[model samples]
Target chain A: MHAILDADYLCHLGFIRDGAPVVLPTLYARVAERLYMHGSAGSRPLRCAGEDTGIAVCLTVTHVDGLVLARSAIHHAINYRSVVVHGVARQVTDPAERSTALNALINHIVPGRAADSRPANAKELAATAVVALDLNEVSAKVRTGDPNDDPEDLALPHWTGVLPVQRTYGTPVPAGDLDPSVTVPGYLTQR
Target chain B: MHAILDADYLCHLGFIRDGAPVVLPTLYARVAERLYMHGSAGSRPLRCAGEDTGIAVCLTVTHVDGLVLARSAIHHAINYRSVVVHGVARQVTDPAERSTALNALINHIVPGRAADSRPANAKELAATAVVALDLNEVSAKVRTGDPNDDPEDLALPHWTGVLPVQRTYGTPVPAGDLDPSVTVPGYLTQR
Candidate 1:
């Protein structure tokens, strides 16, 4: 579960809003047994979490590793690694905990980034809402290897294989206002 | 919205379960203004949608374009294209609609794939459940360009830029039982 959660920094957060289910993609970071996600202070999920009882949420992170093609359409599948957490997310009001969660979110994107970048100011922090969900009811599911085909269908004259899908990073395009002297950091290049 | 939905086959589906929101990653295909997804007949969401008036769901598809790094932690963001659909998904019982939905699901993964693979048998179709949601209440949100950093923070001696992220496909690995004579299909290689 830890490995799957740490592999990606983005997740889909689901919560009920006005008797309807709402799913939104947001940035997330994992710290030990807790998962933290932040958004604008005025966001619906954040506001609901701040109520008397925190909102019940189901946070999921999925990594599509490959496409499994089989001889039959019914047998086709996708190779993926996913982690799902079911819990009630509460607003992080403590100053120390909020600071740690914010730093973790930054570092989660690019390792060692929190130290290299400027920390959030008081005004900036005030405009953000951070929520925490404990990883107690977390489960990790994975699907790998070849496509599953029936023995009778093996000779059906159809191509059966796994199309490996991977996430690749291209050259970093520097900001227009960046100074020429500021070279690309080792953490960014080494990844 | 059509282009974004057609670019990816996997989606995070959210629906209310026991008064709590549950998000699960599943395969989806978009045909015109309707979205189709399928799973086992016994699945919770499928069973719920098969009930009286169907089930309210929020289906979302997100493509992470790049990582935006800013001088300040608060300004960091992700460049992405996302489509969210909020509606009631009902189970499809008509044989014709089910067949079309299944074909769309296969072709959505790889164009021209449905023709190459064998069609599902009667028993296979009986065990599967297909659901369709009209794209009536749909919204597409996108974020692009450079990171938004304050003018004062631009010269803070920190690296700021956009790290482009793309999905790449590797060579197809054939299944062990696949006949050696069945070469890789053009549809898979062309992509």
Candidate 2:
């Protein structure tokens, strides 16, 4: 399983409103099994699209940076990477399918979470929507490492190096009113 | 200073090529301050007759999922929130001004790391492109806590609660073949 590079990069399946696709940033998750996402079968936009328009899906970008390293000026390069995915999402109309998909997404966030919390009842199920898409046509672009210094600059006295950039999560400050004894779960503490 | 509620939303900054607007993601950071993102210089789309058009951006997002308590279904209501800032972007062209803007960005990612790393040299500066935006037009949305079930399911008794999602960082794995005795820094340990 690939580590989730960033939470903001999570692609939560969404439809084009009026015209363009709308992606929500917090949809990214990591799973040992196939990654699952939210798609709605009855979403107003999905149901109205004609055959020519085709099933629509969009991805959300969470993080991007143009890193500039220096030794000399001319050898500079833009060191960056990103995630992109394309898919035709179909809303899962069947009840059983919705429940399973929701669980998969919950587990997609953290395995065993669905069990610890209650499963969706009929109404809750209806309240939620699930968009299903084949886990294909996905690609990730990653770039790392240091500045590309010219051979001539190798002996220069000036400093040269990479500026490390990454996302850092703070201690999970539980809901303010949460009971003090509700220990910070081990999974969260691991961060 | 507002937290970008959702960085997944994409918008056209200006006209480029056919209809493309240099398609960039919604990922943003408020480096100058937590919420001082006001950079609106002009109004609406900066259309440039025959020349390329640009935008005056000054927006951001904020998502906050508040605490919720529910004894059973129907009694549950979530307390969550998020924000999004959509607007045009401005290119920081002035030499000194551009440098200041970029340095803010570098420090935003790593507190003291910017000071610790080597500064960009002159030739390197020309290669880097920097953009600034304002925090004017924006929106935020949120969802939180338990599911609303019919009054009947409350007595049926399946454990009911909220599932939280979080992010984590793993131990930093260094590049191989380096000195093994290099001590891990305190900043990393805090991470």
Candidate 3:
């Protein structure tokens, strides 16, 4: 569960439309047992959510931790943690839930961000669209540790190990026109 | 074109099967005008590619670069570079091409890795599958720079800037069972 919450908020969402499969990468936030995805009113996936019959969608998030190098190419792999959720997505039309869901999305990316940022105004809320999916039929998979090699190949004189992949935050780059008097916030330094 | 070539080799592939859409994350390679995805012979997406009629698929890769913090929550966004390809995928049956594709896939993740590791044996080749898709319909979208905030909200006394996201390679961890004499290769240090 911590993997699901701590991993990046980006996800790949897939659904069928017009007899063909379509997939897009989008931002997503989980609030309790529900997940919400947001976009402008004109986005194709968001439009599909508004169809009379809700869209059946699959959303997935993955974190590649390291490359598992083995003596044989056949056994080479990546150690990763991933989550997959299958559900029917419907457009969120209620104003209150939309605000809450949007806030969750914002905070999920950066904790305490929702309180610092100004809430959306009525016009902005009307232009933005949110889709909600119940987190049912969800599964998480994780792989770790070093490469698994066959006994015979272990003596084949090849380097074997894990090249760890890591993500970090660099210095904050201010907007070109931002006021120079403004200082970086405390929340941004936590990461 | 560079975006497609430089992105991480992992991608989310989407395809329709039995009137339902399925999506999965897999390793992929780009050789000239074609993109190839690899997996075990029994994988569902690879199996779908073996059908008489090619399977319609969408493949996507994304790199999130920053958190776009805005004065208003509605304007908050992520800076990212992404590529999406829509095409029909077919199983690669030619043995020579399969071998080349497999090598490309391996090298895409780590340069010179294919040359260092043992090539797949005949038995291993028989148990692996490769799917190829032409890079005909592909589009890349990128967002960079600072947050986009409304003029009114720019003066809202909230921090506004971009928290740059970065990925780095950490020290390699050798397999517990690796030979004590084996050393980390120079290729791993280039990262």
Q: What TM-score does chain A of each model score against the native chain A? A: 0.98, 0.68, 0.95
- Candidate 2, B1-191: lDDT as tens digits: 24342232222222222222222333234543322211222312222211143443323233323223233322333344555444445555677766665555544433343454456676656545555555565566766645554555444433334434332334544333223555444444464
Across A1-191, the per-residue lDDT of candidate 1 in tens digits comes to 99999999999999999899999999999999999999899989998888879999999999999999999999999999999999999999999999999999999988898998889999999999999999999888999999888888878989999999988898999998899889999888987
Looking at model 3, the pairs that clash are none
Model 2: per-residue lDDT, tens digit, A1-191? 14433344244334444433233433433333334445343556446332444455544343433343344533333344545445565555677766676665554443444554556667656655555555465566655666666665555443444434444444444443344555655544464
What value does the lDDT take at residue B73 in candidate 3?
Answer: 96
Q: Which prediction has more favorable DockQ, 1 or 2? A: 1
RMSD of 2: 7.5
- Better lDDT candidate (1, 3): 1
TM-score of 3: 0.97
Q: In model 3, what lDDT does residue B123 have?
A: 90
Q: What tens digits encode model 1's per-residue C-alpha lDDT throughout B1-191?
A: 99999999999999988888999999999889999999999999999899989999999999999999999988899999999999999999999999999999999998888999899999999999999999999999999999889988876999999999999999999998887988999999998
lDDT for each candidate structure: 0.94, 0.44, 0.87
Docking class of 1: high
lDDT (0-100) at residue A51 of candidate 3? Answer: 81
Off by over 4 Å in 2: A1-23, A26-36, A39-55, A60-82, A144-191, B1-51, B55-82, B113-117, B141-191
DockQ of each: 0.90, 0.12, 0.85
